[model samples]
Target: MSVINRVLRDLDQRQQQQSKGSYTPAAMAPQPLHWTWMIGIAVGTAVVIVILLNLYWWLTIDTDPALQVVEAPVTNQPTVIAATAEESADQAVEEVERGTDAESASKPALQRGPVKPRELVQVPPSPTESRTSELEEAEATTEPVVSEIPTETLATVAPEPEAEVEATDTPSTFAVERVQLSPNELAETNLQKARSALRRGEREQGQELLEKALTVMPEHVAVRSELAAYWYGRGFATRAVAILQQGLDRVPQQSQWQLLLGRILERMGRIEDAYIALQSVDSSSAEYIDLLEVRGNAANQLGYFSEAAQDFLALASLKSEGRWWLAAAVAFEDAGEPAAALRAYRQAAFARDLGVDARRYAEDRLQALGGS
Candidate 1:
């Protein structure tokens, strides 16, 4: 059994050795890629990279050569279209020096070609170069330069005779003429001046102006009213009344005149005259409140208790004052209207703004009238 095992082991060792000998190693395998092929590939990739880099550079480069050049002239310098007179003179001098002025000038003028338009160009010449170019231009034209007119042309162009404008005595359209005022307008003007003078304390001047206004138009209500107001303020009540009456005689429908007259008469203690003057005053007059107050007092003084009560009630209706209510109650009591008097007394006694004496009087009146 041992001998057989040794033979089998020997056979296994021989089989292993034959298998090892039959298999080829990686280092001994056939090479698919050579160094030359790798070198060639590397070279081609490098060339391709260089070409791409160059192509990118060409595309990204700024190729405008004019943008690199500095602007020769200031941007603000005015463009020089034609040469100046001095340049023309210099050109003329040079042409005379050349001895063939007509032939040379005519030749250049005939040989010159049409000018072509150029873009993205800056041809601003130096001062000396400009002068030279002007001289060349002068030599190239046989006709007179822009700055000089030939003697023949000047002689051919005669001066036109100027027309003479004759001076005439014509009235100016804008001259201010004196405006002629009518008598009424003149009176109004004087009245305004009188009022202004009175406001300034020029009493004598104001009176004179007022008189002048009345003289111009005696029927002038406004002038008469102003004069009456002035006289009334100056303590000349009779004169003021006289002036207002004169206005009323002429313009009887003027309610303001009547109001002023009534106020003056009432102040002068002429109660009957005041009542008559105020009777004609319209309820819509601006002096209606004054009329109510003065007429009411006048009526009460003259024993016209019913009219006085009506006036006081109207005033109460207008202002809702406790004093007015009390006045209304007293007038109603005197006029024999106990019901209205009692109601008015109650209102006065309970009034929000009643005076102490007024409220006490209202309470006594209410108690007398048997009101709660």
Candidate 2:
């Protein structure tokens, strides 16, 4: 049994030796490739792949070189807009000042007032009227005899006053009583007497006499004319003009009556009618020369220099002397026509030295016309 046991153990030891000899050093150590190492390498490789993909996406997609992006300034939009708008406002203000100076040079200077010129017309006295003296004689004669005085006889009696009687005449001496009065003339005398009484403060007598005179000759021209003068003296110019105009129509050629009518017309502010009446008188007639002067002066005052010139010229022709020539010259100057004015001034200067005033006036006008 012992011997069998030793042999079996030796067999077992031999079997063990055989197993050790078969095992190499590489087999005795761990295996070179393990499951855990393999898993760690796989995870590291996946992490590397993910990092490379992220780097590629960042480089290729996030940056673009072709697009240009501009950032706005820090200022507000309205402020930037205002800065741009300021440059356009300065160009509109320079065009308005040049149009006002060209309009003032085209008009004439002002005249202070209307001017008067000189010239006039003169009417002569008629040769046909009955003489004042003849009327007086007829008034004294009976009606039948007065009627029997021939028209031819009446026409032959000169109406003008006698030169001798005129030289001796005075207001008192020439009173209506000196020559016998017609009924009409007597009524005029009474009216004049009434005016004188009124002027002397004898009012009741004046009124009574005027009433009696009017009763005797209701429409007598002399009586009406005297009453008209009385009313005029009392400041009733309108009534005076009415009466004098009627008197003038009845005796159109009586220069004395016409003179009174002109005066009444002037007093009534009927300037045109006054001028016409004044213009009707003969400048050569001694009775109306004073009236001609009045008419010329009135025409001058009213700016009717042409009418004044006419009056002055008529007066100058009648007198044909120094002062009258000067007056006519002045009238000619005022009426325009420097040539005519020059001729008139030469005539005046030739008549008498007009001093510096007339000479200078003529010289200035002549210079204006290129005549001197």
Candidate 3:
């Protein structure tokens, strides 16, 4: 009874001591977030978005070899000239009258079939398109057939005054006027007439018309070129050279004239002259690539393999074609530059963007160059 009383008294004293003080709650552990942490989270999120966008672009866009980066069409085409006032008027009339091109004039305006020209009434029908109509008319009419006249008798027949009057009454196609038209107008008219003549297959007449145009506008480079081209296309290389030479004589240092002359000479088989002429041509010409190719050909013809190789390489830069690359490689081989030739051959072999024949030729060259 003495031990139990002692233990009970100690427990009651401890309970009474804790009841006298205020009760306190447990404290939580500290967790801190600063500005730097927020910034790092934002930056990480932005980086992830950027990476995803780049991946999308990579999958969607594919650049092809034949793809071109087009710019605004502002390059000066020196060879082309604007249409004249007369030509513009003609075009406007043609448009306003038919709401179409010149060919519309051949169609009937108020009939179901093609228009029959009214002038054919007083004039005999041409042998070309009206032959069937003429034959049908002769069969329909009961006109008596005259006796067959001998060729000699027809040739020896006296000239009729009516025929002479008709010949004299025929209107001239063009009446040249000194002051009625400006120099440009004169040139343009002649140029148009020349083109029409060419289209009509009157080669000699076309040449004459172009020459007349050149005479009217002596300083006109385009007219000069047209005349030169007219001769060149007809296989008159010497005549083309002469025309270009005359132009050059009037004004030396004309890069176009020189370039064209060089081309003509190259065609004429005057290799040395062509090389010399081409060497003097300015690099700023509109057809710089053609000049490079022609000069390369000239150099090749002149046995200047090193120069030819360089020129062909420059041309290859202008046109990324297998044929140009192959030409450069061949020129390099001729110039004893095996290393450059090998590189070019490889490029040409892999240049599938070029023409079929060019790729085939390049592959053949690659095989010949001891490459797999």
Q: In lDDT terms, which candidate is top?
A: 1
Q: Spell out the clash pairs found in candidate 3.
A: none
**What local lDDT does model 3 show for residue 296?**
89
Sort the candidates on TM-score, descending order.
Answer: 1, 3, 2
Candidate 2, superposed: residue stretches over 4 Å from native? 1-185, 188-192, 207-225, 282-285, 298-305, 320-327, 350-372
Over 1-372, each residue of candidate 1 has an lDDT whose tens digit, in order, gives 999999999999999999999988768767699899999999999999998887665333322222224345567534454656566556545533442454356555234333222223234456998788667766655466577789999999886544322223344478789999999999988988988898899999999999999999998877888888888888999999998888888876477788788778987889999988776667886778767888899899999999999999889888888888899999999999999999889989889899898899899888788996
- What's the ranking of the predictions by lDDT, best on top? 1, 3, 2
Candidate 2 residue-wise lDDT, 281-308, digit = tens: 7545556786887788779768787778
CA RMSD, predictions in order: 25.3, 52.8, 47.5
After superposing candidate 3 on the true structure, give the runs of residues whose Cα lies further than 4 Å from its correct spot. 1-181, 201-205, 232-236, 252-256, 354-372
Point out the worst 10-residue segment of candidate 3 by lDDT: 61-70
Model 1 alpha-carbon miss at residue 131, Å: 72
Query: Residue 90 in candidate 2 has what lDDT?
Result: 29
> Which 10-residue window of candidate 2 scores lowest in summed lDDT?
91-100
Against the true structure, candidate 1 has what lDDT?
0.78
